[model samples]
Target: MICKVAILLVVASVVLASPYNPYYQQQPYAFKYGVQDSYSGQNFGRKEISDGNVVKGTYSVDLPDGRQQTVDYQADKYSGFQAKVSYTGQYH
Candidate 1:
């Protein structure tokens, strides 16, 4: 009986906490280097911000073939010079 009750409580808690879980919903924020609302030139870089903190940034690399390589990032203080990329699929 007690075991079943505990299991039920655990399941309830898990369901309730799922929404707040980082895996599901992340807080909306800007980049660290400060991204412009729009980019005009070929080469561009920008920052990411989350909860008023500089989270990460994105930079555009001008390739010799005229194709631009865009990079996105997420914060990782423990990993030296390491960050996660957050790419946007559509502009609209």
Candidate 2:
């Protein structure tokens, strides 16, 4: 009986923690990401939103010269892709 109870608990935990489990659901239109490594001293982050036809997003990356560049973009079936990029911080 004790062994059976342990097995049941393990199964229950696995089901609850599974990414594909029906009880666990993720937002269809929401995402977040970040990256950092030796190539750049600072980290970069991006956020995005999208449906079937339209996509909009923004990203910020730190440059090697101590500046930060931020870009905002949008793309859709009608207008295509467009982006606006800006920079900030001190550069040697």
Candidate 3:
């Protein structure tokens, strides 16, 4: 009887200590790439896609004064790199 009780306690403890949580869902792979510094209020990120001679990517930065900037760029053996940036208001 004591042995059975000890085994039951061990099993219960193992079940309760599991790392899996049902409430949290994993994010998609594309959203996972980025370096963010919450303490400094800054973030930087880039992602790329390529085919043959052409390569394209997106870059983003978060400023310390509550503004964000993003750029979409592309480059090729023939056309060089070109980007367009979008930002909100002036820097404070």
lDDT of 2 by residue, 1-83 (tens): 99999999999999877756565444449688998877546689999998755889999999878899999999875899999
The TM-score obtained by model 1 is: 0.33
Score residue 14 of candidate 2 by CA lDDT. 94
Better of 1 and 3 by TM-score: 3
Query: What digit string (tens of lDDT, one per residue) describes model 3 on residues 1-92?
Result: 99999999999999889876687554323322788777866688889777545777898888766678889988865789999998875788
Name the best candidate (by lDDT). 2
For model 3, the local distance difference test gives 0.77
Task: Residues 1-92, candidate 1: write the lDDT tens digits.
Answer: 99999999999999987745555445566534433343554454655566533356666644445455566665543443554434333333
Q: Clash number for every model?
A: 9, 0, 0
Candidates in descending lDDT order: 2, 3, 1
Residue pairs with backbone atoms closer than 3 Å in model 1 (clashes): 30-48, 30-49, 31-47, 31-48, 31-49, 32-47, 32-48, 33-47, 34-47
Instruction: Give, for candidate 2, the lowest lDDT window spanning 10 residues.
Output: 19-28
Candidate 2, TM-score vs. the true structure?
0.60
Candidate 1 yields a Cα-based lDDT of 0.56
Model 3 bad stretches (over 4 Å): 1-32, 89-91
lDDT pick, better of 2 and 3? 2
